[model samples]
Target: MSAASRAGSLPANLQGLWADGLNPPWSADYHININIQMNYWPAEVTALSELHDPFFRYIERLLPHAERTAKKAYGCRGAVAHYTTNPWGHTALDGRIVYGLWPDGLAWSALHFWERFDYTRNLGFLRDRAFPILKACAAFTLDYLVKHPRTGKLVSGPSNSPENTYIAPSGERGWIVMGAAMSQSMAFAILSRCEQAAALLGVEPELRARCREAIANLQRLEIGSDGRLKEWPEEFPEAEPGHRHISHLFGLHPGYEIDVDETPALAAAARKALDHRLAHGGGHTGWSAAWITLFWARLGEGERAWQFFEKLLRDSTESNLFDTHPSGGGPIFQIDGNFGGTAALAEMLLQSHAGRLRFLPALPKAWPSGRVRNLRARGGAGVDIEWKDGQAVSATLRPETTGTHRLIAPQGQRIARIEANGKSVAWKDEGVRLARGVVYRIAFQPAG
Candidate 1:
């Protein structure tokens, strides 16, 4: 039922974890939001050799607590109600989480699960854990996003951009400019996943009709101004001097929802907004750095991708993580930051931007000695890549993906030799193993 190919030939060790210049295990917990209840920062970062062992001990202390909470609260239906947090109704209530409304937390978790399962293809975990959660999460959204009043369309509102919003025109409402961002993205993800689940459960017409309706209602998020992706409705305005969350850039990099191949001009405008943020002291938070890393990777600024990761991951995370900046003093160990961190690292170490999956494409000059294997990137085709002396040394690609890819070699070299479905394409040392060491450009369909 799954359309994206999870199969690849990378050496098993490199499959699920991020590999750049370092390792960050605690970051993984942030990704899944193991407990989904506690508001603690994901974890603290520290010196690797000095801090790792004790960190594991710290995690061990937390495990039992996290396990209990995960089961009782957030497994799937646990986030059944939105709250301002405990006893005194004290926690700040941004419209990010909900029992039956916003499903970003659940959707976020599911995306990680999707990536992990795609990489490992381990069915034990699937039947035992994730698949069930994914099904329920999709079901929850189906019930939650019925229709919006003013738009009379299937819009998810009262939802802010992660945690950013401005006064609505009426000064009484919190209109989600990017409010629909996550939901729209979620709709596609849910439909695609529910469709996959349907094949397994034999879900009927009604199930899919909901998905169709959600997708139909989704065009609200893409408003534009002077050809750029509009951050808000123009009048409501964006946060001056910049805001922390790059939620509006949801369609840009990691999401794969928008890309140069599909939404080229929109992608370009997104870039313009990114430029505006950076120039205006839109101070880079940890997640901001992560988004920058992915954005640059997509734009094919290889060195920029590398620098973004190096600066962002090293300086923006806290000791609980790896580094940090001053403006937004947040948990050094938060998951959202780590997920963003890892995305940047992944884009730098290996990329599947455009259509061709690649390795070491935008490697930082400082990191010439490490190698990664088994990492899964999108584009339908699964590829395992390795490098030596800073250039791609080898790669094995499997077209388990439904789409086609014309491999581009490092340094933007011309593709001279290639083949698809076992047919030779000119046999001129063609395709040269898919740009083993640099970023590659591609179309949705790689034409022969």
Candidate 2:
């Protein structure tokens, strides 16, 4: 993969060229809105953490150029990137208004750094590499958002939900608008991570405080009148109701703002939105299908998630396994579907996003008997689980750093017994305190 990718273009190329052409469709540029980010989706989940080095190197090279672009384009401090960028770090602001004005590109890319740190738990990397990028993303976000005069919410404006358009109440079509849920959600994610990263370092109290304040002012996601999370804070009808991009779901999957446990109402609304989209012919693209799979997994709907995965395998791939995007009159390959599907599959087997290691939270019935090993969890834990007949039978956990962490059974399924280092341990909602280098084994009671 590395050799082939490097062969395509120097200075690292996320969008690898399948065939040689100077003027390929979409210019073969790194699409930051989703494609470029999706290319690396499976890095940590598939245990390909080292493969992400190229992407980080690309970002490192792009940062200085992005800083200049931010100041020149938006008159904002810190770094920013438009929807499309090239290997030379040239930020493109073409005539297409829908794709041109997005500043959330950097915020989305910065997630890779945070995700890498989550899997590795390298304090040096978090403190030195990831935190700086996250801080800059937050800085740019802070500078970019303006107070919405009516609502007083810190919001980004004149930004379209990536590649999506809507119809105004005045019966006019609009692509660019204010406070798109995607932008606000991305801002919340970046700023929230900045707060977490800063609190971890403990040396940037002022920065941390500002991030906290910004977070407080950021617009909270609101559901529309139709029982769906609004694409924009203002209720506008989608120009393409079946649009494949699930940008509004940023908070549900990649971002942690909305969850099934804490934000159950919003989570339900998101599920309804997904149902509506699917009913209206959404999830047509491979990447969109993969995201819906992840969303279902996050919602613990294994059957639904697996159904999407099956569709992806059946409809969205070439013989060689490259994802095929069937837009622009014919099928063109996009690697994001492949990577995103792999990550979603992992999410179905195990989820650690909410500071808890959940076993088979969304295990599909078709995968009743299977095993997964060496999956990384937050707080530096290595997890391996075996299940049979749709129930987790046995599991093992090893933590790189000693700490107390929650280990939850699948939703309502209870852990009949848990043993740590060959001794019985009590289960608490707050979780158990674990020591470094200790191997904990868990066993579940047989199903009736």
TM of each candidate vs. truth: 0.63, 0.95
- Candidate 2, residues 12-67, lDDT tens digits: the string is 23335463467666777688888878777777776677778777777877888888
Residue 12 local lDDT, model 1: 10
Query: CA lDDT of 99 in candidate 2?
Result: 69
Worst 10 residues of 1 by lDDT: 39-48
Candidate that scores best on TM-score: 2
Model 1 lDDT tens row, 1-448: 0111122311111112232335433322222221221111111111011212222223223333333443454442222223222212211223334222333554544444444344434455444444555565566565556565555666544454554555566664354542456556655675566555545455456766766667666545464655556655344655443765555676665466666556777778777777776776653666567667777777666777777777775777656564333434353333344545655666666655445545455676677766565555543334555555656555555543343344545543333334444555342222333322333222212123
The global C-alpha lDDT for each of the candidates, from Candidate 1 onward, is 0.48, 0.83
C-alpha lDDT of candidate 1 relative to the true structure: 0.48
Model 1 misplacement above 4 A: 1-103, 122-128, 148-152, 170-179, 200-205, 233-235, 317-321, 325-339, 353-356, 359-374, 377-393, 397-411, 414-448
Query: How far in Å is the alpha carbon of 307 misplaced in model 1?
Result: 3.5
TM-score, prediction 1:
0.63
In terms of lDDT, the best-performing candidate is 2
Q: On a 0 to 100 scale, what is the lDDT of residue 355 in model 2?
A: 76
